[model samples]
Target: MNAPLTSDASPRLEDFPYRISDNVRFADLDPNQHVNNAVYATYFETGRVTLVKDRSHGLMPEGLSWMLVRLDMHFRSELRWPGTIEMGLGLVKFGRTSVTLDQVVFSEDKCVASAQAVTVLIEEATRKPTRLTSEIVRNFQPWRRRGVNVASPKF
Candidate 1:
């Protein structure tokens, strides 16, 4: 399991290498008038999916796909509508078949939520876990989170 991001020490958005902006839709609000908790998961997913599925980045290889194995999120503050959010993602750890990522959602420079997600590489045809290829691991180096010492990927 991954350690949760504590309130006393919140992460900076700059620490995340990959970032994208999204709007807070009115439909995302709950009866309480704040972005629903479930919507935050979609925000995090957008960050991860945009990074991995982008072909120019060379993260995804043919015949292989990534599967989400775990996600742990922490909501810090209330996110209201009529605003845009900046989502960030950083690769923190690399395993043989899985990669751990730290993701965040920021509104007006304030971190409203954060999460740690684990995704495993799998063979598309067999639907079985597959070891990360060396090329794929190397491609991920540029997306690593700042200040975290991600060890070299082991084949």
Candidate 2:
């Protein structure tokens, strides 16, 4: 696992290797007039899913799929609707059967929220955790978090 980001930490968008942008919908707000806490998870998911599920990435092998097993989120600031938010994802660690990612949601240049998500690769037929193949590991190299020295992917 990567070092936990403190609430005071200000993460730069460039530190994340994979990035995407999304609009903040009015439906995402709560009674607080800001983005609902629960909605942050969805923003983080968009970053991870877009990278892993895209056929061009080759991170997903045939008969294998990824499943979210853990997610730790931090709310740094409030986000309101009527603006675009940039979501960023960085591969932080690789386990025998799981990969960990650090993700963030930034409104303008300030990080509004961040999360660490763990997803396990599973065998489609058995629904059992599956070891990561070397090919998949290699493909993920380019997505590593800046300044992170992740451990080698264990089979």
Which candidate should be chosen as best, given TM-score against the real structure?
Answer: 1
> Which ranges of candidate 1 are over 4 A from the true structure?
1-8
Candidate 1 residue pairs that clash:
none
In candidate 2, stretches whose alpha carbon ends up further than 4 angstroms from where it belongs are 1-8
Candidate RMSDs in Å, in order, are 2.1, 2.6
Measured by lDDT, the strongest candidate is 1
Candidate 2 vs. true structure, TM-score:
0.94
Candidate 2 C-alpha lDDT tens digits along 20-58: 999999999999899999999888888999999998999
How many steric overlaps does candidate 1 have? 0
TM agreement with the true structure for every prediction: 0.95, 0.94
- Model 1 lDDT tens row, 1-155: 96654422688999999999999999999999999999999999999999999999988899989999999898999999999999999999999899999999999999999999999999999999999999999999999999998997766
lDDT of 1: 0.93
